[model samples]
Structures are given as C-alpha cells and as structure tokens.
Target: MLRRMFAPEGPTFRELAVQALSSVEHGYDLLAPKFDHTPFRTPESVLAPVSRALRELGPFGSGLDLCCGTGAGMDVLRQVCRERVTGVDISAGMLAVGRARETVPARAPRMEWVRADARALPFGPVFDLVVSFGAFGHFLPGERPGLFAQVRSVLRPGGRFAFPIAAPSRPGSAAYWMLAGFDAVMRVRNALWHPPFVMYYRPFRLSDVRAELARAGFAVRLHALPELGRRPDGSPRCRLVVATRAEAV
Candidate 1:
C-alpha cells in the first residue's frame, strides 16, 4: 500500500524534499501539478463517507471550503449545497489546479476559487456550510483559536464548519512512532530552516478542537462515519466534526 501510494507517478523524493525546503506557498506552487498523485492527497475512502454524511445534513445554500487544497472538499459541497460552492486557499498554484480540474453539471452549483490566508479570510457571514479536508497539519498549534474564529466569521448564523479527523494511532504502535518521528523532524527542520513547511502528523487533538470551536461561538457536534469502519476496540476509526455557528453569532 505504501509503495503503490508513493509510486513513480507521484512526486519523487528529490521533488518532495525541495518542496519541504521552500516556503509553504512557494512549495505548494512547485508541487501543484503533481499533488493529487501524492500520498498526501485525501483518499476516496474518506471523501466518499464525508460526502454521504454532509448530504444528510443538507440542502445547504452557499458552501465554502476553507484551506481547500486542490478542492477535494468541493466534491462534498457539490453533493450537498444548493446554490454555490467556493474553494479558498493560500496557494495560488493549488487554486489554479482546482479551477482547471473543475467540471460542473448545468444543475450543479456554481463554483469559484479564491486565494487568501485562512487566518484572515476575505469573506463575510455568507457561507451556509464549510468543510476542509486533510489540511489542518499546515497550521501550528497556537493558530487553532484564531483559525476557528476566522471560520466562524465567514459562516452565516447557524452555518456549519465540518472536517474529518481520524483516531490517533495507539502509543508504541509503528504508526504512532512514525508520526512522532515525523513531528520531531518537522520541529528540527523548522528550527534550522528559513521557511518552515509546517506539516505535522499529530497535535490536532479532538478535545482541544471542540473546545476551541466552542470558544469561537460554534456549537459543535460529532458524527461517526461508519463506512470508514472501527478499530479493534470497537471505537470509530474516523469521525466528522461539525461545528455550527451559533445562531446569535
């Protein structure tokens, strides 16, 4: 599975190393063309279940995809939203690729792409639903509060901000150790490099995220994505965090 995912068709190790060395925006700019082929891209197994879950919550009107990398979350918006779907990201290269790949049926909602920082979004309280996929690792832990607030600011009263999160790997397990090592490397790289790549496999805890969402004036909820299946302990392997903007906010 690992070999097939990082196959020859994807960006080579040298190319990935170059990307990691550059500033986040420039790195994605260099990587934009081949990103979908990489293991970093959100897989269909996750997307499919997310789409189904969002469809159940909707009939939503304008939907926004926050930090939408190459617009993977647009697929979910298109399925659930009624009027329009927009993808906003910090990387121009990523937005361009998403724009180029977009195909909408006549009946489908209109689509738009914007380039902007997630921390300071250039939008009002206009979106009815918002979703992001596999892009949180780009943010530092300190940015969570402001990031959640920014998400709330762009959502209409009673609007929703949704994303998928998986269960953390068990401690001492290979996956857990691998992620720990990856985070350690990232920390070292950020300490030594001029422009940090800002990708870490861990540290976005569910409890902290939910608390921050509440602090940002969102009423949070969780929905199990059964299609993703469960762990050996019978707990859900993945879940969708749906943070609705409080009606007063």
Candidate 2:
C-alpha cells in the first residue's frame, strides 16, 4: 500500500538517497515539492486530532507554525486563530511550497511565511500561540534546552507552545525495536557523513522533554487527545504538550 503510493507520486529512491546524503536544509529543499506525498509529512490522522485539541484551547489572536514544512499544520492555526498566522522554516523551497499551497480566503487570518532557522527566530515576543508537528527528531537531546528557550523567547507572556507527542512504544515491542534500529542507523550516518541529516526516531522521551520545558521557563501541561484512542494500558496513545510561557513578573 505505502510502496504503491511512494512509487507513483513521491520522490524516487535515488532522490531520497540523494536527500539523505545532503544537509538537512538542502535535503528538505529538494524534498519540498513531493513532501506532501511522502510519509514524512504529518498525516491527517494526527493533524485532525491536534486541530480538535487546539480548538478547545483557543480562539487565539496570532499563531506561528514553527518549522512549518509544507504548512500542513497551518490548517490547525487557521481554524483557531482570529488574527494573523505565520509559518517559519529554514528551507526556502519548503516555504515556497507552503506559500503556494495555503491560500487564504478573504476573511481568514492573514498568512505569512518566513525563512529562518528555529534556533534564531526573527521576531519579537508577539505570537499568542505556536505549534509544531513532527519536526523534533531533527534536534539532538542536548540541543532541546536551547530550542525550548528559543520557543519561549518568541512567545508572549502566557502564550502556549503546543505540539502533539505520542507515547513511546513499549520496550521489546516491534515498534520499539524498529525505532531503535532507525536511531542507531542515524547515529552511524551522522558519524560517517559530512553535513549530517539529523532525523532520528528515538531520543525525545516525554519525561526528559517535560523537564526541559520547565527549565526553559514554561509551565508545562499535558492534554490527552482522546480522539487518537488509548493504549492497551489505558493511557493515552497521544497527548498534546501545552507549554505556556510564564506571565511577566
């Protein structure tokens, strides 16, 4: 099923190989056109539930889609924000595709795109809400503190940085082993290659991430996305992490 979809509309194996060997920014630029067709794009199953969750929390003034990719996450913002919305990413090619694909209706919140690394966002502390989807695997564990701080810096006091995170697959399960193998391969690839493509399947554990968010000056909370269903243990399969910036002193 997935193979048929990729072969027809997605990037060829050679294209993906070339991308994997390139720098993250360059690789995404190359992948921009066909990104939506690829599994790398956040699936609608995830996005729809996220949208429903955010809707309950918002009617926000302005929003930013951090590392927006092809702007699929922007649909969530459009539904919940009453003012302007912006999508920021490092790759010019990805930004271009997002801008072209997301056309605003006359009454919709205004849309804008900016090309900037998430590490150094080019904006004031203005946004009321900021959301990211499926972009965290790029950041190493050590880099998360700075990344969270950067996110905090761009948000107004009490503004929320929301993103959905799935529960880790149980240890020794097939999903666990698969993710473990993928991360191991990424480690090897980064060691052997120049301009490392930093996409790993593991390493962003919820416990560690919650601690980092607290240290980064956020009041972190979790909202279970019941729409995505529950695990066999009765815990949520996915939860939305809503990290609110501390109000001004």
Candidate 3:
C-alpha cells in the first residue's frame, strides 16, 4: 500500500512512526510526497459535489485554497473563480509537490502558491471565496475560533469559507469502531510524545463548527451535498458548510 501511493522518498515506516509523534505541520511535511495516494486525501467524490455546489453559488472573483495540500482545492478554485486562485499551506515539502503539479493554463484563472500557516495568513481581505478540504482535523478545537477569524480576515465582505463535513459514524458500526480505535491510539501517542499530531475524527462536531464560525462573524449555512447519498437516518452523508463573512461596517 505504501509503495503504491507513496514515492520511494516518502516516509518509511520508521519515519512515519516518528512523524506521527510530531506536530501536525511537520507530520504533513513528512507525508506530503505520498499524501495524495493515501486515504487521507479528500476523495474526488467529495470534490466533485463541492465544485458543483460552488458553481451554483459562484462566479467568484478571487479564491483561496486554505491548507492546500497538493493543490486539489486550487483546482476547484480554478473552476469557480474568474480572476485568480491562491493556495496557502504551511508545509514547504507539500507546497513543493503542489507546485510541481502541472500548472493550470494561463487562459484559466491565475494560480499562485504561498507558504504560510493558516492561522496567520499574510493576504488582505481580497478573496471572494475560500475553500479547504480534508485538513481541519489538524487543528485543535481551541484553535478553531482563531483559524476561522483568519479565514474571515482574508475574505472580502460577503465572501465565503466552504468545506465538506461528512456525517459521523453511527455507534457500533465498523466505521465507528475503526475511528474509535484510531482516536484511542492517537490519544495514547499524544500522551507519550513530544509535539502531538492533533487529529480527531469525532471532536470536530458540526454544531461546534457552526458556533465558532458565527463567533468569527460569519453567517453560517449548511448545504446538503446530495451526490454523496444520505445516512441511514436520512441526514446528508456529507454537507458543505458555507460560512459567509458579514459585510463590513
């Protein structure tokens, strides 16, 4: 599995074991070479639904791909934004791989990659849309307000921050047990390690996320991405959280 998805230079078992014990950014840097191949990368299924939703709501002027790993979100931005698209990520290694990907043609929206922490973006309120995929679990709950504020700060009034959130697994299901075991292993790792990788599948509840977005001054809405199908309970299997920043004073 590792050989199929990860390049030879990609982290070895020992390297990954060490990286799992590091901070989130460093762990990603270590994993970047093989990231897209891993199950961790956001699937094309989710991306297609999100792109369709944004197309319905957009024609956005400029877009930002937050924590863009390997430029998947930037590709979505290219399809939606008319003016320009920028990808910002903290991992130089990841950004390098992203940059190595064939650039979108000049006839398309201009593309640029910036290396920076999401919590401290350097751009002004210049983006009409901001989208992220599969990177939120890296942030601790306490860090969410500040992170949302950062996203808000970079977006123009009425611009949006959008990302997909899948429904949590029902208790006693195989998926639930797998995630539970993973979380337990992570907790033990963090307890015994130095810089901990902050990823928890369950803790990033949608309710808490909506509240945090509101606290950051965004008007939050959840759009069902029907292409992903529905849960047994009939709730959307996946949703796009559209957090629009209120118009400035």
Candidate 4:
C-alpha cells in the first residue's frame, strides 16, 4: 500500500532531477501536481497520531499549517481546531493544489490558503495553534531562529506550535549514510549553483532546535507519539515538540 501510493503518477526520476536543480520555491511549484503521490508528502500514519495528540491537547480555536504542502497537515488541523484553519506556503502552485483538496469536510473549520514565506508570515497574533510537518529541512540552521520567531509572532500568547521530530538513525546504518550522502551532494550543489535549493536531512538536532525555540520565547515540551513506536534504546522514535507562547505576566 505504501509502495503503490508513492509509485503511481508520482514524479519521475528525470522530473525529480529537474526539481532538485531548480530553486526551492520553483521546484515545489513544478512538483505540486503529483506531490501527494510522492513519499515527500507526510503520510496518514504520522498524521493520525499527531492529530490524536493534538486532539488530547486541544479543542484549539484557530490553527495554522505552516508550509502546508497540498494541505495534508490542514486535514489534521480541521479535525482538532474549532474556529478557523489556514494553510500557508511560499509556493503559489502548492497552495492552488491544496485549495482543491477534498480532505476537509464542509462542516469542518473554515479554511484559508495563503501564499507567503514561512520566515515572513503575513499574520499577527491570530492563531491559537501553528503546526508544521516535513518543511523545516529547507531552512538552514542559522535561519531557524528567525523562522521560529515568525511562528511565535503569529501565534497568540499561550498558543502552541507543534511538529514532529524523528529520532536520528544510528551512525554507520544505511539510513545514516543515505542522509549523509544526500547532504554532501546538496552542499556541493549549493556551492556551485546560484540560488540554493536547501533541503537537508541531518542538520536539525533536537537540542539545538529546543534552544532556538526557547530563544524565540516559546516554552518547550516534547510529547512522545507512542503510536510511531519506540527506538531500541527505549526512547520514542518520534516526539512532537509542543512549544507554547508564554502568557503575559
């Protein structure tokens, strides 16, 4: 089932190569048609558990899907948030495709699709929750502070910003080598290319990320999504970072 979804009508090798060579925003625009069919789209397995956790945490009012590609995360927000849901991304093509998604029911939260960079979100303190999935890799480590601050700024005080972070694959493992090689190739590509298409696999560390979030004025906590199961070391394979904006003193 997983193999079939990612295999059918998804981007071809040549198409993926073209996208890799293109600028980040333009690459997504090119891939928007078949994005949902690609493994790049966050799967239902992860979404289901994330939504369940958010449900237990919430009844949140307004929600934002930061960098929502084809609105997969928006569906989760619809189920958990009551007032309104917004999906914002830099790619207009992605937003257009997401607008046509049938995942959200008419009775669900009212929805908005906005085209904007995540680093420079065009919203004030209006959202009670902001969630992002699988989109952080595009930003360099230096960019995380400003990006987190932007999410913090858009969220109302006491609101939450949530996303999943998977446990690192053990060193010398196949997954580790694959990710390391990918990042190495990307580094070479960016050094030679004009506008870098900056998707990286290994740069986001939980400790560094927590520090950045704290610097952005968020009180951070990690909720283990046990449905994803645990690592051999007994730690969770994936944990949701639930960072809340501090209430006024």
Tens-digit per-residue lDDT, 151-204, candidate 3: 999999899999999888889999899989989999998899877778886798
| Global lDDT scores for all candidate models | 0.90, 0.91, 0.88, 0.92
Residue-level lDDT of model 4, residues 1-249, one tens digit each, is 447544868877788889889999999999999998888889999999999999999999999999998999999999999989999999988999998774656678899999999989999999999999999999999999999989989999899999999999899999899899989999999999868899996989999999999888999999999999998889999999999998632
lDDT of 2 by residue, 41-121 (tens): 888899998899889888899999999999988988999999989999999999999988987887999999999999888
Q: Which residue pairs of candidate 2 clash?
A: none
Looking at candidate 2, the ten consecutive residues that score lowest on lDDT are 1-10
Misplaced by over 4 Å in model 1 are none
Candidate 1 versus the native: TM-score?
0.97
Full-model lDDT, candidate 2: 0.91
Candidate 4 — what's its lDDT? 0.92
All-Cα superposition RMSD per candidate: 1.2, 1.3, 2.2, 1.8
lDDT of 4 at 6: 46
Model 3 earns a TM-score of 0.93
Query: How does residue 30 of candidate 1 score in lDDT?
Result: 88
Please give the range of 10 consecutive residues that has the lowest summed lDDT in model 4: 1-10
lDDT accuracy of residue 167 in candidate 4 = 95
lDDT of 1 by residue, 1-249 (tens): 567546877777788889989999999998899888887778899999999898888889999998888988998899999899999999999999999999988899999999999999999999999999988999988998899899999999889999999999999999899999999999999999987789875989998888888988999999999999999999999999999999764
